[model samples]
Target: MKFTSLLKAATTVAFASVLIACGNSSSSSSSVTEVEFFSQKPEMQATLQEIVDDYNKSQDEVKVKLTSVPDAGTVLKTRIANGEAPDVINIYPQNADFKGWAADGQFVDLTDESDILGNLNEGAAEAYAVDSKIYNVPLTTNVSGIYYNKDAFDKLGIEVPKSLAEFQDIVKKIKDDGQTPFAEALGDPWTVNGFAQLAWIQSASSPQAANDYLRFSDKGAIKSDEVSKNVAAYLDLLAGNGQSNSDGALYADTVAVFSEGKALMMANGSWALTVIKQQKPDFEVGFFPMPGLTADAPTMTVGAADMAVSISAESKNVDASKDFVKYLSSTEAMQKYYDVDGSPTSVKGIDTEGKFEELADVADLAFTDQQAIWLHSEWTSEEIFWDVNVSYIKNKDLTAYTDALNTFFDTMK
Candidate 1:
């Protein structure tokens, strides 16, 4: 919500200023060139500002102006098409549909820049690469897990559930005892998608399974039985009488429910920790991996770089932009960013204890030799996947859902 609000505010400011500046502009080349950074999260602007301040202090050649745009992917596309695009942009590779953009040569390839590419996490580097060409440099990585109210679990004598069946049983018991089992924000697209993503991962055990379901590839088989069954089970749990929020509460409301201690458990990515801690410092909170669907199935969590900074293909100050990005990726810069934002650093071996202790255990599990995958929306057309998921959840029509998914894949061509 902070991010959304920030984007709207930024757009209003950009629009008003653009109108006024157009009247006074005589020679645009003489003034400080602004490197507009379109970003979704308002909080990220603070981290970027830190880097910009440092960059500006050290050099007089270029001035980097960052603008927070809501729905950055859409904004970037529209601006680029209108020939008013920025020189540098910050976006989630998944949300920005970086792969498709790269295929169309809309983004500048940074594959040859080993200095920037080498500093990123392996998974992040791979995600930022399309057709073996790197287009973006990751700023931070976020992972998803179950956040529980420590006091509630302790009082209920409930250990963190380790398997899906156990988790559902715990939820049912909690409900039977007149307490909400889980807090979900269906209104917030991310919150609804968060649960859908968890279910997708649980149903699709292997990496290949994820690729098949998410990418809609014809090569991989769809475990429709597993996926459909899990979807029904998860929805049944959410739609049960014990949910704290109203029947169709959005994601923000769901988060508020958990932060206010109305629910025992809420599924969210690491970013929620900041808001939770800020709002409920006295509340004891802990996290665990989303329980595995099968005992032997290795646990997999949703993860991706929080933001990737890329040089715009139309950038006039490419060298300065690259320098700025390089500095942003340095160990010192990343440490500061992580400290300020509670974000997990992309640089390997950076100590996280002081800033992100809540995530220490989960982060350890994530970095283990076990494999992980990005969220489904990250690899597919977000509009199609998100719409199909919401429809399936609300309607529970398996045939229609699967057919729509197959049609989505056909459209990808």
Candidate 2:
């Protein structure tokens, strides 16, 4: 519970010394099963370890050790490459790496894990479903949107817009008021990448609308369509409306600018709110889903599976890993994670009423199955797609979008 326990997961110990459980449900009466859980979520490391500690103390049958390191993606790839897959892992199901590993049977097939999947709020698990089958245990869900400064909006007498046109008008109104419209940090490709994805999601239709359009529509949709063109135009509008010299601003700089009340809005995921909160700005910050084509459609939140854990299919200790994963599904464990992280719980019964009020509006979209899993997660190479969007944002060229759709066909479809 102290600051020191946060380092519990940052160990370099190999799995060679641990007692691996037999694959079957039953283990030797005298021996305790040792299970490895490699995690990439640094923020939740200690929380996970605390849960592990509780689980370990509750029983002597299996011990779950959390393994985390700096540069976890590379470490995980190397471990799996060397046939040292952790028995359990925390992975984002929407990422390309998760897709590849799931396809290759790196994780256990949880299609029949009704005891686990059934506990989650509807679509929380399905949003990240790999080929309609569940491979990861969805715990907490995160949503993306525009975080607006309440004081700034109040000063300008601005109301939250419910349509794309209205949203554009707000941008113009902010600009006309001689204030910055957005804190877009183009210097950080990921920020631009987030804005691009959110634009496409809100512009196309709504949650599933964006999901299907990107995955099943014509590959040329980005090349020739009102929707695609409108999205591109909006991206152009956003690129031009950012804070002063925003193209060179770092992600931290945007947080600072937005926190200082110099910028009206910031396009980012739910995680950014944490950083903004730390700065203790005078005004209240609120979040709303990116505006869609119409008022009713304005609440589409773009996000994905957050803090999802899965078991390795190739593990020698399947039973032990299952035991650990089952423990994670308990209402107590999920609630512990939800309480500390302030993230919306994917589990069915944890009440999030009045918590994280800044996230209230978008949280509705998140739990009600309204979040569109990040489209890049479905791509063959999401980074390359992100690079294309970044290219468009910087050069303000439409052809970069053509390259994006080409990536959709070449790597995604």
Candidate 3:
């Protein structure tokens, strides 16, 4: 798989080298317009370089040099402050810093980039829009959920559970059969945050409750019995049946452990499929939206645009940067990205029929249902929620979590 293969290739290249080679400033003889493309996702370094190579080879008018750095938000902010911002940047909308950046007009207003943005998924594009003006065009989008091993389920005579009790039964069965029920990498806050987001969504009593979690401004916002119970249930699942070393496991460990069949399930997104396929090519996998808290309340999905391409408002070469961003939105670029990234594209009319063969019914349900929730919208500062979620996972202390959330909410308001 491109994800695994390219990542391996990326390791051989020094990070400092990649950062130094930001653009084609050294090539004085080259007449092409050189656009510096910056991205925060280190995993996509080699894959993005491939995308840029393909684009440069396809045309001569402009050249894109890819610079993938760490700590995306901090790096981007520093670059902007230093007046050395990349010409085109890949933005992750889920980052809390993006809200400030959008408001500050960091990126060029893309509302008028009709040719590039016209065929995009309207819901996703609208998510990136501020004041009816969009500054970024989504590159790829994915849904977060429980990714499970289908072969293990079939071997154990387990079917997809419709209710939370049934799901817990399957988890217990997996554990009884000498298998790890879940691949939990607690070292990464985002993984636990994903689970926390699902729990909050499943605990919601109404659609309004699910959508507007941030509106609960009271001190008891996170102290409700229902939410505390759900949080406890989630912690019990991880602590009781997760992989042996899951307490200290990292993101790479989760991918390796889950892919190698050491675990039966992973709470993750559609992107894990490719890497898992790469590790165990014949392994069968399936996905389900996080099961609801009880039978009466079934699970619903929350999705947001994971990646988007935007041009720096301060770019010296606006037209060149626009060209690169436009290329990123084209069908060819999207197809290649979807193939490697293993996520659904937001571009309309792009055929993704067998693209998600690993996920059969789960794919259908995600696309057909329109109840898309931006999970991050539940909190004013996502970093605070991440910390609270990690603490909850570590201790299952609902009272402390609630107090922290209330304090954070008070600051936000």
The numbered model that scores best in TM-score is 2
Off by over 4 Å in 3: 1-31, 70-72, 205-211, 214-216, 294-298, 360-374, 377-380, 394-397
What lDDT does each candidate get? 0.69, 0.78, 0.73
- Per-residue lDDT of candidate 3, residues 238-328 (tens digit): 6556788877788889888888888988887776777777786356878877677676665665566666777888887899888878778
**Clash number for every model?**
4, 0, 0
Full-model lDDT, candidate 2: 0.78
Q: Give all candidate RMSDs, comma-separated.
A: 11.8, 10.4, 12.6
- List candidate 2 stretches off by more than 4 Å: 1-29, 206-221, 367-369, 399-413
Lowest summed lDDT across 10 adjacent residues in model 1 is found at 366-375
Q: Candidate 1 vs. truth: CA RMSD?
A: 11.8
- Candidate number achieving the greatest lDDT relative to the actual structure: 2
Please, what are the lDDT tens digits per residue for candidate 1 over residues 138-199? 77767788788888888888887777788788887787778888777655556655556667
Models ranked on lDDT: 2, 3, 1
For residue 198, what is the lDDT in candidate 3?
69
TM-score of each: 0.80, 0.86, 0.81
**TM-score of predicted structure 2:** 0.86
